[model samples]
Target: MFLAFGFVMMLAGFHAESDEEHKVAANTAMVLSGVYAVLILLVYFAQATAVRLDSLGDEALRIIDYKRLGLFFSYDLLGYGVMSLATFFIGLTINAKSRSDKWLKGLLMVHGAFFIGCFLTPMLGVFNSKQSGVDWIGTLILEVWCCYFLPICILSYLHFANKSNK
Candidate 1:
């Protein structure tokens, strides 16, 4: 969840370095990043607090339960979708003069495509696990996400660190 906050800061840094032609896209990224952060924060906080209600009926509990692919899970996925949009815009704002920056830019743009799954997953109700509270598909998706993002993060770190040196 803290990734939401860091994602905003990452967008901010991108905005800070953006050229005049890219500022509009960078600004859009920043706004979307904020929305992403708020949505995720609300979902997580509710999971930590409100969803813990002792008096909730079984049906209501099912809706709020973090264990199931319920309403809150939908909201969480939506939040990530918004984050994907933010990163897409961030990618648009990059000029990508270096190879690292070029890879970062491409990765950010590709990452945005995750929004499609995030959108359709809830509506289609396609993902399921054989065991309760153990979503293997979700786990697989997350593993894929982490694997894809590793290069992006590494490239971004190198890009900024090299920038600071110059």
Candidate 2:
């Protein structure tokens, strides 16, 4: 994901009319993507090291320190939210140059909405219950939003970039 976005930024940098805009966009994209990549790596580490909820008794589970898990969630919320907002800004920049790139702009907005929704879920205590069904719903929401929405946004951005380059 970071690589794809980085590539888009590189292309955008090359095409950007002003040196300042190119530098800003290129640097911002790289840093935002890098932060997200690191956050994903940290999530993997947390998953590997954290005790499974299923392995503990109810009393033990209640006593389990959730600080690390909370940190993981916080990191995900911040990283994804920031990345989504950055992508929205990038989309706006692209749209400014190419008024015909409506689909890309719309897709970026949708992607931003999903990330915003995900960020709000924890705050709303949507996942506070430990029901498997609720967990599954949360997972499904994330999968659909991130896996489907982001890929489509990237594709639409690329399509517009290609068309504009021609």
What are the lDDT figures for the candidates, one per model?
0.83, 0.54
Instruction: Please report, as a residue range, the 10-residue window in candidate 1 with the lowest summed lDDT.
Output: 127-136
How many residue pairs in model 2 have overlapping backbones? 0
In the predicted model 2, the residue pairs found to clash are none
* lDDT of candidate 2 at residue 121, scale 0 to 100: 68
Residues 21-81 of candidate 2: C-alpha lDDT, one tens digit per residue: 4566545655665666666656555555555524655554343333322445555665676
lDDT of 1 by residue, 40-71 (tens): 99988877776565577778767776566678
TM-score of each: 0.87, 0.58
Q: After superposition, how far is residue 6 of candidate 2 from its true place, in Å?
A: 6.4
Tell me the spans in candidate 2 whose CA falls farther than 4 Å from its real position: 1-30, 45-74, 96-100, 146-157, 160-166
lDDT of 2: 0.54
